[model samples]
Target: MIVTELRFENYRNLKNNTIVPAENVNVIYGENAQGKTNLIEAIWLFCGGHSFRGSKENEMIAFDNKYFRLGMNFFSGGREQSADIAFGQNRKQIWINGVERSSSSYLTEVFSAVVFSPEHLNLIKRGPNIRRRFIDAAICQHRIRYASLLSKYQQIINQRNALLKDIRKHSELKDTLAIWDDSLITVGAMIMKERYDYLKMLREPAKTYHHGISAEKETLDIEYQSTTKTDENDDFGTLTGKLRAAFDASQREDFYTGYTSVGPHRDDLDFKINGISVRRFGSQGQQRSTVLSLKLSEAELLYQKNEERPVILLDDVLSELDNSRQDFLLNKVEAYQVFVTCCEESNKVQLKNGKVFYIENGVVK
Candidate 1:
């Protein structure tokens, strides 16, 4: 998808203005705290997901303003389309193609995008929750139903945890734990299967990108660490059985801790560089490259599955990289419509051919 026009009003610190970006690459450069990243966040909201920066809906409005509105005109599914978001008085309204919608989820079917920011550079260095979130979000891009599945699994976990806590006090209620276990095993197994399959597909493209980024000096690997045994020969039924066994084994522990512990929620992804754990030993550059590779691979997989290219958003992620790495990034993104935000005017020179815009105090000049 390509965004042809973007309009904003009272959104963050950005001035009420409209921007028409180029079809290929657009480099947005400006000084620090001048709303370069805010522009990227605006486009990302069209994806129907929450702010990648984790800002609440009320927090997105400008100071002293009760609401914020973002609109975009884009080409998707072989036609021009438009979407709008208006948030105020603790209410959010969404519209696509001039038709009103009840929820933002409808926007995902119309627009898809992959975003990379400095916070993602810590994907390899951070805890397992971040890695799990990355994998889950990538899967949701293509598998829309997976999002509901995740919600169901989390609900099951919460209910099961409550039961376990009650079982701790009422010994007679222990028998009912079996029902929650059965539900957890069923939903948790499906979640694990989806996650495992996505990580498996992500491995190859991620490896190729990492190899090119490293100039073939190092190899990258991704392994899905599941709570249940996930051998290559295991199928969905086998996975279910293994999860059931795991839940049975952890029954006492679950009651003692008053939480469900053995499920997809406790799983993680392990990134390795040359057979060494990237989280424990990879350099800063390696961590950054690894995240970029995963992100690019996500875009590739989305295109492969849907036959539509998702917009790429790079939010101030080029500062710490060397010239060669920067060149690789620019070259790799040449095939897609990408928006790159930077703090230096010279960064726009790196893009051999593209549009350039400058932002000063929230106004694009």
Candidate 2:
């Protein structure tokens, strides 16, 4: 998918601006905090119905402004389409092809975007929640039902944790805990099963991409870490039984800690390089390569599942990589539409066909 044009009003530091982006590679260059990232953020929000930076709709509006508006024209699957998203302190709406609609209804219909930022380097070394979020977000884009399942699983976990906490003060509530346990096992088991299936599909692509980027010297392996041990080929019935048994064993400890301990929420993804844990043993370059491989793998997976490639969003990430790595990234994304930001044109790696937009003081020139 390619974005033909974009218009923004009262968005971040940009008051009112419009530009037509190149289909292949569109480059935005400016100094720090000069609206380069804000432009890309607007495109990402249009694609995903939310901010890649985790900002709320109101937070994305311009300073002292009451509302913000962003509209984009896109070409995909040999057809032209347009979408607009508007939001204010109290209201938000989305329009597709000139028809007003709910944001969630058609959010994923226009396009898919994979964002790379310097902060993503933490995927391997940071806490487990970040890694889990990465997987969940990718899965939700391709499998819409996964989002509802995830929400239900989280609700059940919250209820189960509350019940565990109450059990400490009143032993009588312990019997009522069985109801929450049943709910947790049902929803949590489905979540775990879906995650396991997704991970299985992710392994081969991720390993191949990692090897290509690392020149075959380093081997990357990803393992899904669950609270209960189960074979890779185990069905949901067996896995659910194991999860129930594990939860039963951990009930007392969970009550003491005031949290449900054994479920998908507590699970993690493990990355290893050449038989060593990437988080503890890999160098900085290795960690960066691992993250890049994972993202590229995601793009490939999306393309394989859907015939069209996902759009690429590079948020000042190329500036942090060496020229060799930058070249690899640029070459890999040659076929898809890419939006990249940098401090200046000279800092960007050379590309065959790209349009450069100079951003200065919140204006695109």
Candidate 3:
């Protein structure tokens, strides 16, 4: 699927405007804080992604403006489609075509986007939560049910944690913890299964891309260690039973810790070159290649699962890569729609037939 058009009003420093992106590749360049990334953010939002900059909805509104709107026209599944989103400090709503949808779940149904930003370089160097978020965000877009189960599991964890804390004052709360445990196991098990399954599918593609980008000098391996025995092919019913047993064993310890300690919340995705971890021992180049491999793997996985290539959002992601690696990425992604952002005009992304846009003080030309 490719974005055919984008329009936004009162968004950041950007003036009210409508844009028609290139069918294949587009490069957006400007000085820092000149709204280059803002353009990419608008497209990413239209593709159903939250701000890679982590800005709040209010921050997206223009100065002195209380509301912002983002709209997009795209071609997906052999037809034209559109998505419109309205944003405010306290409220946000999305509409697919002209009909309003209940939630953002409909966003993924119409379009898919895979994003890469400079911050993702820390995917390996960062803590487990970052990796977990990487998996959650990517998988949620592919499977809406994964998002639902993951959200339910998170709510169950929060409520269960609060109950654990309250147990200090009301000992009777201990009896009801089992209720949350059941829900947690039921939902958390599904989350773990989906994560494990996606990671498994991602492994071969990531390894191959890492091999190509690294010039065949290094081998990439990813292992998903879920809270349960996810490596095994146990059915859902059997997995639920195991979750129950694990939670039952951890009940007393969880009560004392005032948190739900055993679930997907604590899961980790391990990255290795040969047999050593890229996290602690890998060099800077290794880490960069690792993240790149993971990203390309993400795009391929999305295509394999959805049968459509996702739009690639490179939010200043190439600065971290060497010229050779950058060339490798551009070549590999030539068949897909891409948006690349750069701070300098000399940005080396070779998009011969691609449209180049210059942004200055919020204006694009």
TM-scores vs. true structure, each candidate: 0.90, 0.88, 0.81
Whichever of 1 and 2 has more lDDT, that candidate is 1
**Per-residue lDDT over 134-228 for candidate 3, one digit per residue giving the tens place of the 0 to 100 score:** 99988876787787787777888899999999998999777898888888888877887787778778889998998888778789998776675
Q: How much does each candidate deviate from the true structure in C-alpha RMSD?
A: 2.5, 2.7, 3.7
lDDT of 1 by residue, 249-341 (tens): 888788889988877898888899999988889888888888888888999999999899999999987777677777777665667899988
* C-alpha lDDT values of all predictions: 0.87, 0.82, 0.82
Candidate 3 Cα outliers beyond 4 Å, as residue runs: 16-18, 64-71, 83-106, 151-188, 226-260, 347-349
Q: After superposition, how far is residue 226 of candidate 3 from its true place, in Å?
A: 4.2
Q: Quick one: how many clashes does candidate 1 have?
A: 0
TM-score of 3: 0.81
How much is the lDDT of residue 334 in candidate 1?
A: 64
**Rank ordering of all candidates by lDDT, starting from the highest:** 1, 3, 2
| 2 against 3, candidate with superior TM-score | 2
Residue-level lDDT of model 2, residues 1-365, one tens digit each, is 88888999999997597899888887788899898888888888866566767788888888888999999888877799888888886799888888998654586876777777778888988999998998898888778899999998898888878878888889888888888888788887888878878888888888887777766777889888887775557788987788889889998889899998878898889899888889988888888888878887898889888888878888886665666666666555577788888886745557657788888889998
